[model samples]
Target: MKREMEDVVIVGAGIAGLATAVALKRVGVRALVLERSQGIRTTGAALTLFPNAWLALDALGVSHKLTRSYDPLVKGSVTNINTGDVQQVLFSEQAIRPVHRKALLEALAEELPTDTIRFSSKLAAIESQEQGGGASIAVVHLEDGTAIKSKVLIGCDGVHSVVARWLGLAEPVHSGRSAVRSLAVFPQGHRLKHEIQMFVDQQGKRAAFIPLNDREFYWFLTCKEENMTGEPEQIQREVLEKYAEFPSIYLDVVRHADLSTISWAPLMYRHPWRIIFGNLNKGNITVAGDAMHPMTPELG
Candidate 1:
């Protein structure tokens, strides 16, 4: 029997891949998403969907579903926890909403068709056609030895995308800093007024805390790259040690944290204006999001 072909084969099931699949489906295209992981894992601390992304989500018809479950950050003010000084207030006047990374992924995943995603399908290689004038095709070889052919192969795989490497794209550069993030449920009777605080000390290290709906507050700490590779327990200890001089409530928050919630990653990014991947001869192979340009969380 002849091998079957997919209209589109997207690698990775992160934000970019899922959103692209949903968009393609909306436009009447059938796309298959291949994810290396078994399922969506809520690992990141929190994510701020900038106004543009917010609008994009609205256009995609998922905005209401997301907003309904997440608390819009009606108020946000940056503070210098070191000296107890206020730096600049985005004030509740301007609307900025923060959502848990996991929640957003869950919602996006729910919007997608149940049969569209193939998990544990790591891309091992991609064979692209370079000759002839006919429509180009891409063959994606999965780790499990299953080969999938498609008219278009989109690499939505994250920083270490195999498709990117297969296409000769350079590796991602580290930003020389590492960040640790954690989310915790506020203790009973401890009412946390909704506020997002950023504490910058004299040493240049920084920490942030934001209150989400349901009495959950997200906290993060950024430090030199050297401090981030250790175990999570050590990282949590280092966080406590570094922020020891802050207000009692700040330290108290850490003390009461659910240590298991902490996660860390060394910041990495690709040049924004640069097109790491060459032009697709037949518009059959491309990349999006982190695969194209992974960057720090500058809220851009």
Candidate 2:
């Protein structure tokens, strides 16, 4: 195996990993990001970023770039699908904007030097120890016979993180709820308001749609599930059937949405109590993001 050394090594090139690297770069610390996938992640629809996320980006010096890229969404409302009652959504100087994941990642990455992220470098195992001077070091073994030694090892991998599993953190708990999301496109364009709209029924089912643009909108459906089984095509059909009674606009969007962009995810979470009592770090290894706090996307 080829041996390489670095100041820090981060696993998983998701939002957490790239964001961390960008923040570190502001302080002159460059980390080597190892992603299991072949390239940068480009999935998911629009993500709502509140004030806290913007504050974090402010510290990293990229908040202006994000603000420029995404339009501001200052309001959202909840409507009952059965009763057709709408609740007013008001904000006092608070603004939230929905930004595409790919654009956000690209914005963060633009601040760093070239080739900062190494693609397809799946981590297979890790070995760590205290050096003769009592300083800690970790050696990460990749699947392709490459060993990386670093003083700091951070895991930003998602819920199924290998690093979190090795740390003996409790397994993610099934929340009995699953979700499917897709970006709906309208060739003729839509007259929907720019604000976010959520439609829910009494059966604990939710269908929310947020406009991405005049021609494209991002939507998601969350419902109770017995298991995370089913083919993509089957799940797509099931989602359509589940929300068959929703408002006409929602129904039309779901029906005409791109099946290829639709995705299914079973919400899973580790208990917050375990994070306080469990080992968060051992030597030079630690975890962040979904790896540290995997939960339902309700508050994410």
Candidate 3:
């Protein structure tokens, strides 16, 4: 018996991988998106798709729709926690749409073709070759002893991409800081202004809040990179204890949140165009998104 070949095999079904699938399919090419995770699960806090990111999605032909504005009571301001001096402020009032991470992923997935994504296809290595007919060929090996051959290979496996490793790219560099993020509901009566607020300390710690929907606000606290191995209860208590002296509005959001919904990660980044594999003359293998250049999640 003989096996079949695919046009392109994508590693990672994240925002970048899924988006690429849509783009390739629209151009009449078949794409297979492989995800290491067992399912399409999104962890971490909510996100604000700023104007730039929205434009990118729009160019991809997907619209960014929000059920409702998150921060109607927002009073935009950035303050220095140590000196109490204002660094930036927008006195003018306006609503900024915020969306849940799950909602955003679902929406993006909806735009892609079905049967193109395969979960649990953790990549192990890639081999390149020249072909006599049609597009050049590259082979991908998965951790579970499954091997897929494709005419083209794209690595969208994120910052810790195995494709990058197979290409001998260096590991992502730590940015010296870590971020703790979450989304919590602040009761209707406790609705905050629609302005984003940020507090930065001289010790390299920071906290921020942005309302995504009427009832809930997205909040985050960043501190020096440290190990997080404590129980959820302990993690929750430590988060609250860190900002015990914050204003009532801050506490109110935390009051409605538990450690289960909290998320944290150390910031990291990778160089652009770190490595290029596959048939360069034929353009069979390529990389995209964080696999190409991983960076901190700042404004977006």
TM-score winner = 2
lDDT of 3 by residue, 39-72 (tens): 7767676776655666666776664344332333
lDDT of 1 by residue, 1-300 (tens): 235589899998888998999899889998999998899866776776667778888878888877777666655556676677876665443246778887777777888789899898788888986647765679888878888889889999988877767766667788887788887676563587666777777665777777776567788777667555577778778778867877676676776666777888898876543443443233578788888777877623
Lowest lDDT 10-residue stretch of candidate 1: 273-282
Q: Which stretch of 10 consecutive residues in model 3 shows the poorest summed lDDT?
A: 273-282
For each candidate, what is the lDDT?
0.76, 0.82, 0.71
Q: 1-300 in candidate 2: lDDT tens per residue?
A: 689899989898888998899988888898999999887776665577788888888888888987875677767799997898999686545477777777788888788777789998999888787798777899899999999999899999888888887788888788888888778888898887788888989998888888777777788888898343577667667776767788887878887776667777888888889889988888779999899889887746
Judged by whole-model lDDT over C-alpha atoms, candidate 2 comes out at 0.82
Task: Go through the candidates in order and give the clash count of each.
Answer: 1, 0, 12
Better candidate by TM-score, 1 or 2: 2
TM-score of 2: 0.94
- RMSD to native, candidate 3: 3.5
Task: Sum up the clashes in candidate 1.
Answer: 1
Q: What is the lDDT of residue 43 in candidate 1?
A: 75
**Residue 49 in model 2: lDDT:** 79
Off by over 4 Å in 3: 1-3, 67-75, 91-96, 132-135, 187-189, 271-283, 298-300
